[model samples]
Target: MNFESDRIWLYAGEDTITNRGVLVKVKEVLKPRRLRFGWFSKTGWSWLFGSIIGVFLEDFIEGIIKETWLVIVVGIAFGLIFVVWVFWAMNIQTKRYSLIILKRRHEQESFWKRNKDKIIVALIASLISGILGVGGTLLIQLLTKM
Candidate 1:
């Protein structure tokens, strides 16, 4: 009786293991190392500095409002709502990014390890632009005066 020879499977070296996957894992592991710093650089500094300047601005604006109470009241109400909206929008974006990271972790997919820097830079640029857009518009209005 002639027995059929069993086929042997040959696995390739490191290339078979997916470099993308490895890169993703590496990026994930390195995230926390710079995440806080990145966030501090992105929003923390601006928020802190803005708050300091805002306190003085608020006092100045308060005086103006006291003199024109009716207009000031309306402005304050609108301003408060706008501030809430901005924070809520930021929270939503942050949560979206968090979810993306979680998904990549679960899928074991390459986590943009190669593009982490670019991803962060892009994200930061968008945030800065939003801030500048809002601030610039307000500043222009303030400068124009009635």
Candidate 2:
């Protein structure tokens, strides 16, 4: 196996595990001490569960939107809140596995502890963006009303 410019190449007859040809590109390369297929299996399960929950939640929200007599502003606020809440919940659910994966490579330090400030900044940025998006939507609605 050879790595160049974030790309990995498995030459023919070089890799014993999979003797065929394989090429892959990744953002970064980290040699894992051990392979655990279980992690990937768990990720698949998590994704499936998240998808089901997301779909159910979306349908519930759609029903509420259709059944209620909410104003445009109120609806936009609810939509923004719901989207942020769902994303936050999903992130909380999946972050543990990602931390575990990172810990395997960087066992000397705690991932969250080191990146807490950056995470906070990112969250703040996202909140600002969400607020701006809602504001823009409200502005468009007001303009159309005129």
Which candidate number has the best TM-score? Answer: 2
**lDDT value for model 1:** 0.57
Query: Candidate 1: misplaced stretches above 4 Å?
Result: 1-17, 21-50, 57-66, 69-82, 89-146
Per-model TM-score on C-alpha atoms = 0.25, 0.32
Superposition error at 7 for model 2 (Å): 14
- Error of model 2, residue 43, in angstroms: 19
Model 2 local distance difference test score: 0.56
Compared with the true structure, what per-residue lDDT tens digits does model 1 show for residues 42-87?
Answer: 4554566567546656655875857877656655665675566556
**lDDT by residue for model 2 over 30-68, one digit each (tens)?**
434223332433345556656755655655567576775
Choose the strongest candidate by lDDT: 1
Clash count per candidate: 1, 0
